[model samples]
Target: MITTVQRPTPADWDSWYTAGWPAVVTDKESESFHRTVQPYPGMTAVDLACGNGQWMRQLTAWGVFVTGYDFSTEALRQARAAGLPDGLSYAQWDIDAEPIPPALMPGSLDLVTCRHALPYLEYARVLTDVGRWLKPSGIFYALVRVADDQDNATAQSDSVLESFHRGFTEAQIDGIGIGWARRTTYRLSARNCGIVLRGYGDSDCQPCDVSS
Candidate 1:
């Protein structure tokens, strides 16, 4: 079972970004994104908690128009300073505090992504919103740290313990997706996992699947 820990505040994120924290995308993450999302030139995507906009940049490179949201002003500032493409934009929005933006009309987006930030948000509500925001063929992708049984025994410091607390167990992750009528797939890595949720109306939607 995963234990609860104090969540990081927006101030904590601002401090980290101000300290020059790097946004690193792993090979597994890139591969999983490409394999699952299969972006096309005209696809539109929304990235939630898009710190530094690294994923936004990647998606834009594949010719997808992306709108990114982050809670930390400093993070959004750095992302903008890094330069935005013609089809990409960033906004400072706190997911926990605000309702889904009115601009994101029902069934308008092709993809919605929440990476490394799902554990911090009210994810059930987020999932429901994403379901409504996406087109019939749209997908919701999330990458999150997974809690392990060995975490408590192997953790070397308070930071490690805090990280453990922030993770969701495989069961917890599975349970969340099951509550909504959608196809759910899991792509597991050593310390993290990727989840893809497709609306039930989608032709390719299935009950569940697990892949490497």
Candidate 2:
């Protein structure tokens, strides 16, 4: 299990949201997302730590049914105030404090995504739950900051360094042991990266055709 020594509480995130921290999708993140996920009409998806519902909105735009989960009430409020699309919904759930929701049945989900929040989550447990919840052809996608010597050297504060210390190494990701049939990792930037994992039952292990 990936242990997190320190993580932001819901109140901290509420304050951040109140201070206008938008869930801005950067160009690199967009590129990585498009490359990693292919949503079809009627597909079911869940976005973890789905601040402000940016990803849920995007997936719904592509005709997918999306349920966004977040711990911050303020973030969910902002997300709802933005207007939910036909197939989009939001729920408040503190992943660290709670077990996986009973609504997420085994083999029920087509896709699962976590962006910019994996370092704060119990990722091993999350991965196991994702593996159980996903359909045979489902994918688990994650975007996270990378921990490296450069990041450590450039960290602005003790808190920043602590967060960086929680970030994953490429080797760490490879050793996560979710028994995926296929796993692909790619860099989004010098300090950020993404991964795509398919379950053991997924026979179509070929990479997505999208350009890197």
Best by lDDT: 1
lDDT, candidate 2, at 126: 80
Give each model's whole-structure lDDT.
0.76, 0.75
Poorest stretch of ten by lDDT in candidate 1 = 152-161
Mark the regions of model 1 whose C-alpha exceeds 4 Å error after superposition: 1-5, 149-165, 179-188, 200-205
Write model 2 residue lDDT over 63-109, tens digit each, in one string: 88989999999999999999977989988898979877888899999
Clashes of 2: 0
Over 4 Å off in model 2, which ranges?
149-166, 200-212
Clash pairs, candidate 1, are none
